[model samples]
Target chain A: MTAINPVEILLVEDNPQDVELTLRAFKKANLTNYIHVARDGAEALEFIFCEGPHAGRKIQNGPKVILLDLKLPKVDGLEVLQRIKRDPRTQMIPVVVLTSSKEQRDVVESYKLGTNSYIVKPVKFEQFIEAVQQLGLYWTLLNNPPTGGG
Target chain B: MGIDFTNNVTAGGHQVADQLAASFKEISDLRAALDEHAIVAITDPQGRITYVNDKFCAISKYSRTELLGQDHRIINSGHHPKEFIRDLWTTIARGKVWKGVIKNRAKDGTFYWVDTTIVPFLNDQGKPRQYIAIRADITARKMAEEALRQSEARLQTIVESLDEGLVVADLRGQLLHFNHAALEMHGYSSLAECRRHFQELPDTFELHAMDGTVWPVGQWPLARILRGEKLHDLEVRIRRINEAGWERVFSYGGMLVNDATGMPMMAIVTISDITERVRAAAEIRHLNTALEQRVIERTAQLEMANKELEAFSYSVSHDLRSPLRAVDGFSQAVLEDYGDQLPEEGRRYLQSIRAGAQRMGALIDDLLAFSRLSRQALERQVVNADALVRAALEELAPLQQGRRIEWRIDKLPACQCDPMLLRQVWVNLLSNALKYTRKRDPAVIEIGCQTNSGSRVFWVRDNGTGFDMQYAPKLFGVFQRLHRAEDYEGTGVGLAIVQRVIHRHGGRVWTEAQVDRGATFYFTLEEGITL
Candidate 1:
């Protein structure tokens, strides 16, 4: 396989500790070089649409796999996910939901909104890192993203 | 000269003799007059009866012989006070006349009353000579006067004590007579305060009937009397001073007084206070109106709650089932599509997921059944407990096939209960007995009833894996199971549904159990009655 672009693995997480652990796990799994981070849903949407501070960036060069968190300030994760799925430019991109809420309604709704995978973020740090590493390996190396660029 | 003297003497002597004869005849006639006019009781100054006429003797019921020498004490009736008798004697002895009415006893003990006047005849020096009394029978007159006084007193008392005001007014509206009540009714301290004439009374007073129709004074009792109109029970309302405020009075009147010529001369009005009675009747009407409004409000609230519960049940049935179908169907799809490639653990996990989903579906169905029961209207009938139990046992027989079980059915009485609901109760109870006793070699289930006092109590007793009595309170709670799901296979809603049905029939259910011994459930179709 050809080397993936550096911005292909984008993580939108509010917790700094979660972001650090996710990056460390991805490094151990040999997938950290392509990883990027957005602290909130607004920053993630800006990066994807290439607007505001990233105005000059090409939208078609967005992340190949986006790990989205459902809870965030200003704009919620679900609305961002809905906007991404609705727009054709980001509709084909694989977006996985990582949340602490195990509520049945939330899980069903996430999948119905075209989320590629839904995972409950484990409470223990070690278990959380393992979940992140496994998700990175599956989406990056095993599962194939769309060949058609936006 | 001798011859002239002889003639004069002879004429004078002859005239003197004739004057003496005339005087004798006048004396005899005066004596007869005295006997006819007076009851002559010629007593000495000591009141001794020296002479009595035939009339006196007859009135005294004594002969002259019996009275002649007796003092006046012989005829004393003892009716006079001591001072009265003393005064009478003092006056008569002093040559004075004494007049009095005396009650005296006759010789035969009969009593008679007389008006007597006694005169003391005296000599020229004014010394007492003899006493003479003249008396007449006065019993009839005294009796007549007494009867008249008693009748007047009774009439006065009746007028004073009457609750209604009574007024008598002449045809010209001049007030002739009025009762104490009438004075009070007119807000006056006395009859004089009201007015001697009816027209002088204040016209500021308004008179109306109970329904507020105005009544003219010209149509009042006195006016009716003047017009010769006879009025009876004509209700009129009057304002009267009561305590510090004015009160409303209900009245009726008619003409009662008649003139000397027997014509209607005056009118009488009767009245009473009816304010309290009127107010109480109004209050009752208000309460009844409020009660009706409350009933309407309660009925509306009940309807709203019923609609909400119905909507909730529908959502539970539709919304819950949609997702449940997805869970079961997708798990089935995974097994079918990739069974050959999947590991044994993966197949097992998928099967467990399907099992859990199916169990959830069963729970939802049970919940729906429970909800449906609350809205079902009761159909009442006479249910024979023995027959209902037998039918329920038969229905559960397919699950109890080849099991060694002992059944004891006591004589059960018929009761007034809902048949379908009662049957459901029996099905839940007997099935529970069969299920709990499944581990036993010989399951002993006793279906029986006992007559307790005036009520019949039916019970289902089972020798089974009984639960701790400490957990008895939770036995009928929905989804509250004492044993683990692995130990007992149940939805845990059977007892709850049984309780609901029994309660709707106005009955109660209870249980007694000891761990690993047996359990007995007692129920009654009538509240507060236990066997």
Candidate 2:
């Protein structure tokens, strides 16, 4: 766990199984980027704000994109989003809502809250992997985030 | 005829001076007797009181000195007209006898009645010489006559002015007296018209007795009273030709007046219209019967609706679960048995099948819950809203664990509501807030009560991804969502159930939000403790 290296993508998810599946998808897609995982909303917040355990982390260094889930232990995905999007330091970071719910409010609320993209996790593991791979390919290698002073 | 006084006196005297003496004695005796009993006075030809006896002086309340030479006018009560007095004077002037009852005034200004007779003495020329006036006291008889006349006048006024149609008839039903009210009540055109019917005793009206029996004249109210029967409030119906022959109800009562011998002399009857009273009683009875029927029908309809919901809920629980369980179990079995042999994609496909079945199972549960909420009878009790909120947070502790959620919970008031049902409301609202605010690091969910615009508003405010105020209308509908499934995990029944619970408690639910700012959902309980 290279904690000091700049994190390329922040995966804010609570389910350990989902985290494992997403990580495997990233690995199999051959996208060898430094991925930082925050198990819940609180950890994600501390990392973003450079507070608590993530005190040494800087706000300007980008995670490139955040793959967010709506359901999380402690603080939820939407709360995590509001903090990042409302702040000048982390507002420009691309946020993609990745969740298993097909609920329409989840998608609409994510986009309305400045989510860059929204994707529902497919029930089949193969489809889920394919979706995650496409997300990684597009956001990590293709999309560019607007840089700003924080 | 003129009396020959000298001839008669000579015929008696020629026989003897004793005969004249005897006649003089007898006349003197008669004069004394008249003086004792009669108020006698002798008036001159000019109507002056020449002499008055002691009886006249006593009856006139005057002394003999005052009566002597006084005119007869002195004791006149002024009751007689000038012509009447003149006639009496003329008769006396002709030496004729005049007799009449006269009212004379005493010296004390009180009146006395007298039966008076005047006789004039005639000279050789048949002219009046002296007049003798004799009177007998008649005051007691005159007073009795006046009293009888006054009593008769008073009786007539009372009989004519009475409001109730008073009809006094003989035992034979012949009318003796009928008041004006009776004439009008009978609808008679004139006294002649009423007299003909009363005298003839015609069959006047078609009438029904209280027992709904046709009444003949023999059983009529007046006839019964004549036969010595006393009746009170004997309800009867009378047919009126002016009313198109429809019968009208009347309260009839009768009493018979009896003579000293206990024989019924006259019959008195009273009639009052009771048509409106009878109709009103009937209307009230009919309306009450209709109201009872309506209540029975509505109760049956509610029972039928409840039975249908019960059947639907039962099938959803049993029949639906069997298929869902089979799908999930079989998929799980395939994944377990073919784990090493099957390709990775095939294994993943089986997992999808299992997940799909599980999702179906969850859908069924949500559907049943929504339906059951309507059928469920509410057991209302005093509920503490703050305690329920705390319990809901505890229930979602797995989601709340490790989360820095700033729950600004305030002191909540107690309200009357179903505790179990309201707790579910709290869970759904809190979880919805938690789900939508997942992206925020330090989620601030404020749960408390407020008085906004004259309402005791209970609200859950969250510093999370709020929705467009436009889409708020769809927030509480089943399966209505504004976010994608990948972002949040829900069947979209949470808010719908919350709305249902609030509505069942006779309250309303609404939200205020700005996209990406925050959301505040407010609700009001049906007349609860104020914040």
lDDT of 2 by residue, A38-124 (tens): 999999999878899878778887687788877777998899999999998899887878755434446778878888776654223
lDDT tens digits by residue: candidate 1, B138-190? 76886787788999999999998998778777667887766888776667787
List residue ranges in candidate 1 displaced over 4 A: A1-150, B1-113, B116-131, B136-159, B162-182, B192-204, B218-236, B240-247, B251-270, B527-531
Local accuracy of candidate 2 as per-residue lDDT tens digits, B204-224: 667787568887767777778
Error of 1 at B103 (Å): 6.7
* Worst lDDT 10-window in candidate 2 chain A: A141-150
- Once fitted onto the true fold, the runs of candidate 2 whose alpha carbons sit more than 4 angstroms away are A1-150, B1-245, B251-277, B280-284, B452-454, B528-531
Chain B TM-score of candidate number 1 = 0.72
Ten-residue region with minimum lDDT total, candidate 2 chain B:
B1-10
Docking quality (DockQ) of candidate 1: 0.02
**Candidate 2 whole-model C-alpha lDDT, 0 to 1:** 0.78
